[model samples]
Target: MKKIAQFFLKPTVPVVTINGQITEKSVIELEKNLKDIRVSTAKALAVVVNSPGGSPTQSKKMVDLIHNFAHDNHLTVYTFAEDLAASAGFQVLISGDKVFADQQSTLGSIGSITNFMNVKELILNQGIEIRSVTTNPASVTNQSMFKDVPEELRHVYENMLQSQHKKFIDLVEEQRGSKIKVPKEKRGSLLYNGDVFNGKQALEYGLIDSIGRVQDVMKEEFPKADVVFPQKPSISGKFMEYAKLYNLFQTIYQK
Candidate 1:
């Protein structure tokens, strides 16, 4: 009881938590922490994540930062996704020098999704009109899409998603090239069409290095490290809504 009390009273190892949706701001903060030479003091750096994913742009920025930080600081970095880490979140999870996850954790969604609503009819029904000013046909092609979206617009948008998806695939291949193998038939596609998996599947797919809790793994790897929380990812739904709304309007409407 006395030793347990002492353990509670002591400061633990520094474990940075990247636990929410990946956004520009999230990447900014994470990069800031990584840039901190303070990480050099820790025996090993650990990142814990649980997210449904967000912007691909932010995911790439974060993945780059993770790579750069570990290399520059020579700190062994460990990443974890507990419960869930899909889409952009999965990209970040695999960025770890070594990745971990809970046995039942959901992982992977190595694809891009740009969801939108065709509300032009709804607005017209209410007698509301959205006027726009644009310079050219290409410019208006995107902004004029609040209602009936065109096949051309859909095609272009799909191209954009494919472009981003290609990058996602490239990153996975780069990070876990040796550990993962895609059956010949599934090449040029996600591990399973944006479907997430349990830890065992993730490990088999080479999405993670192992399946274990941060505390247990860190205790064994960095016994004397000062475990602390540099920061944590805030789990929320507002960012996902914003991504869809902003991307939809930006790609489909011009004004």
Candidate 2:
């Protein structure tokens, strides 16, 4: 019976969901599940995304993995922007062999951001002994969030962000290839100045193939293949928030 079931059953097209803000832990779970599909009975993969985006570095890492999987394994990869695929979400979306967006989906925001709080006065008033210790001057300049950040440190950080943004543009251009048609407003700014667009605008800018649904996308790629979604790995969402807050406090208060 098992053999008959196996023999008669059709191949499945797995759908991987990328919802919420992307994070390192989330990407780890995504990669592990993707690898399972890569080795399982799935023939094609459809990625359904509804995200406002997150860390650029993490998004780029995911893009490389997805693109490599499709390229090296000779498989079809489709990415569907459900509602929102902004910033880092769009970065990952372009890696697919075919990318689509829902009619009302939002896209774009090609930029990077960093937040730092200068607590020098707060510590001085509290008489806190915040010892700034580091072996390397460069590391101190870049990582040490003590007092006000120096102009040199700001320059270095800005340069780092600019480099990442350029890489993003290059990747999008390579993937879309003469399809990008961003309006004048979205252009002529540092990192495209994090501009956003609706699905129609995104498609005009060659950011997506068409406005479509995940089910339709799967049917286009796999015809009558059954849908197979990998079991989502357990990730403690609330715990991660607490851990992140704790880490931020440590960075701010630790001597």
Highest TM-score scorer:
1
Error of 1 at 177 (Å): 2.3
Q: For candidate 1, write residues 93-183 as lDDT tens digits.
A: 8888889999999988877887676788888889999876655534324545465665666777888888887887788888887788567
lDDT by candidate, in order shown:
0.73, 0.74
| Candidate 2 per-residue lDDT over residues 1-255, each given as its tens digit | 333323444667877888888889768978887876623346767888788989877887787777777677566898889888888898878778778988788888877777777878887889886776666545534455447777767777788889987877776668775666665455546226688888888777677888888887677767878766866434685466457656765876885
lDDT computed for candidate 2 = 0.74
Candidate 2 ranges with C-alpha deviation above 4 Å? 1-7, 38-41, 127-146, 183-191, 220-223, 231-255
TM-score of 2: 0.74
Positional deviation of residue 98's Cα in model 1 after best superposition, in angstroms: 1.2
